[model samples]
Target chain A: MNRLLFALPVLVLLIIGGFFYRGLDLDPSAVPSAMIDRPVPDFALPALHPGKKGLSTADFGGQPKMLNVFASWCGPCRVEHPIIMRLAARADVEVLALSYKDDPQASRAWLAELGDPYRQIGVDRDGRVAIDWGVYGVPETYLVDAGGRIRYRHVGPLTAAVVAEEILPRWQALQQANQ
Target chain B: MPAAKLHAKLAVVVLIFVIGVSGGSPALAVRPDERLSDPALEARARNLSQELRCLVCQNQSIDDSDADLARDLRLVLRERLQAGDDDRAALAYIAARYGDYVLLSPPIKASTLILWTGPGVILLLGFGGIIWVRRRRPVTALPPLSAAEQARIKSLTAADQGPQ
Candidate 1:
């Protein structure tokens, strides 16, 4: 009984510590990027447009670019798809999309439903292309400058406010700086 | 009970108290440096923040993390809250921009039915295991000791009492 009394607290602590250790181990959160202002990674993926060639790193050069990562399974991708289409209509900037973790047919169907505004859509079915692009989730948009340097990144759905206040101004500035 | 026993109990209590206090307090110092003003907005932000996942940290809520991206997400959340977005709107806004991966607790959609119900299914299996084990383990009966066994037990007890 005396030994049990002395040992009870240690036993309780082991249980508590087990839980705390589990929580500590599960510290799921994004790592803040160390890659800002750095050159974007090279990528080559099959084009969504039939009979057309895929996208490459050279596409990012000579033009200010917006790379939107999205998938059919993502609901937010539907909401942001129209805004991306609007952004793509501008000749001043190139809009490229990386279709992540999705079937090519599904992506085509989604684009068909939402209307593809992407000048070039690259399929990254296994997400390796997204990893190389430093993508954490779908619907992330990164603005790369004319020199292929990443200018800005928005992690979540792009809306009018985010577009006007953040993406457009930064893109315009990068484009003007190049000229 | 007795004074020595009380003293012994007090010592054990202090030891356990010290250990418990030290264990849980380490995480409190890791607050993100971001400023969140507007008490009403902050309250709403806090409540809504936990619903959103930090993409880099897949399992953790933006509110619970000190990660830089988590801080940025918190700022985004606050921006939406201040701009008159309700909880669902704010979540949907972020989701629309970032994807469903940004939600800490995923929505009740067909794709997420298994994820939402898996825990209950696992619990039921655990309870079923307990019931099966109880049924499998028979009501154990102690064997009857023979006369020789009783005599040996008596002899052992007498030996413990020494020479008498």
Candidate 2:
């Protein structure tokens, strides 16, 4: 009993130390989405452009869609634009976008300057729709299946490697599952 | 020292104590435009916002964050309150979207079992170890108290009967 007491504190330290040590390597910025496998939240926002139809959840079905949460104000969004444009040109997926809490004119100008990649753009001017979609930051992307369920989510700028490694595999899975 | 000088020194100590106790308030970012017209509702809104995490600044609550998303969340929360949703309902509505990470106090659940019970478990282990050690100790380990020592200890512990 005396020997056990001597070792008890060390044991406790080891357990706590283990948790902290494991935590040290985890990406703190990545807050895993709770919306995985859940159906997309219902929302409809005004079009970013004059005549373009605004995006809605109803448009989520019939294709494996890539929903990119972008903003003109966000720097990383610009960094990922070329990659998103590449994804947009791909035949396998329909790329959609949400302009999160950005000025319509600025968003429009930014898209025009960069070359628009999204098939449909929704102007989430107040960001209320973004809250519904669980968007905490700009440049997040969600992959929605044909049945409109959110299959996977990637926070931060979608890199080419991320698209090729993480997204492509999931997109393929969704395609096989839907068919 | 002069009486006035002594009083001034005492005043400075008291001022420092007050400031120390206050601990500098949380930086409030709730704009004037976001405040509800109804004071009671506004108070509730303020209280509720403090419990919601600002995802941008994960450490700061939405009430204390200056982020644009935080401001938008505050507006949406107020809108929900105006629409007759209870505090829990309003919070749940947001949590449904953002998950439990947006909540300052994580909800007790299967996944968060360690988070909720770890401190209690540690405390219990500490207390249990103390009791176990106490029980395991033989009475011979402690020397028998002398009559004089026992009487002195008893008297010393008695509040009113203690030495004047």
Candidate 3:
């Protein structure tokens, strides 16, 4: 009986440790994109500015685009916004923005304070669109081809290195392929 | 009872209760500065942060911490909010920087099956042990008390009654 008591705690510790260790091997940040090489999901939302329309998946059908998911409330969004604005000037590619779980007024104000680089902004109020995009967090950017298929994903703030090294080349290749 | 005495007794009782409640939460090491003024936002931050483990602190969350890394995490959350990011986005940003280990509530996956199911598995094993113990033990009814044992019991009862 006394031996069993000692063994019981060890057994419990082993079980808990096993679970903890199991989690260490898998990267939860890398969920498989549902839009992988497939046409993007479709939806049009109220535009950020008056008298202008926002995006649906069809808008991206003929051009390679970078879809950046952001919110006015997220901090890293500020860190990554500048790079996105810089990418916007590259006439070869279009930048589509998704405003997630944010008030429209706040989003518009945020863009005004920073700079609006998005060719079109889609509002995802409930984050349903974010989920559909297989997004786990904010400031995630996806690269999509003209076919609306997702080509690449960046999990955090877009750095200069990532843009210069990876995104630009991929965008060029896709642009050339369409021509 | 005198009013002064009654007040003193109440004070003692209250002190004991305070100690009891505070002592139960020894693992709650969160500092005052780590908290927010808004109850709802603070609760949301706490709930979300607790789901994320601190990378430097290992298995502990910012909710259970007083370290510099925890302070940085708190700052990260506030920045996300000020930038117009929602709770999920802020958490994801941190997760991206530190990896999923930064999450206290791990995502559900084939690899995490043990984490999700461990408690029930342990309870089942415990119950199975109890059943095994019961089955292995012999059922022995107490033999009826012998006549001598009854006489000794009667004397003991009589001896006790003599004092009355």
| DockQ scores for all predicted structures | 0.06, 0.60, 0.05
**What residue runs in model 1 are displaced by over 4 Å at the alpha carbon?**
A1-31, B1-164
Worst 10 residues of 2 chain B by lDDT: B133-142
* C-alpha lDDT of all candidate models, in order: 0.78, 0.90, 0.77
Clashes of 3: 20
Chain A TM-scores, all candidates?
Answer: 0.80, 0.88, 0.80
- Candidate that scores best on DockQ: 2
User: What are the candidates' C-alpha RMSDs?
Assistant: 18.7, 6.9, 13.0
Q: Backbone clash tally for model 1?
A: 10
Decreasing lDDT order of the candidates? 2, 1, 3
Give the interface RMSD values of the models in order.
Answer: 10.4, 1.0, 9.9
| A112-144 per-residue lDDT for model 1 (tens digits) | 888988888888866755655657766788888
> On residues A1-179, what C-alpha lDDT tens digit does candidate 3 reach at each position?
86987798799899989989999997754544445675666566667677776767777767788889999998999998999999997777689889987898999999999999988898887665565565656788988887778787887788899899988888898888878
TM-score of 2: 0.85
Chain B TM-score of candidate 3 stands at 0.56
Please give, for residues B7-72, the per-residue lDDT of candidate 2 as tens digits: 999999998998889975655699898999999999999999999999888899999899988898
Clashing pairs in 2: none
Which portions of model 2 miss their true places by more than 4 Å? A1-17, B1-5, B24-27, B137-164
Q: Whose TM-score is greatest here?
A: 2
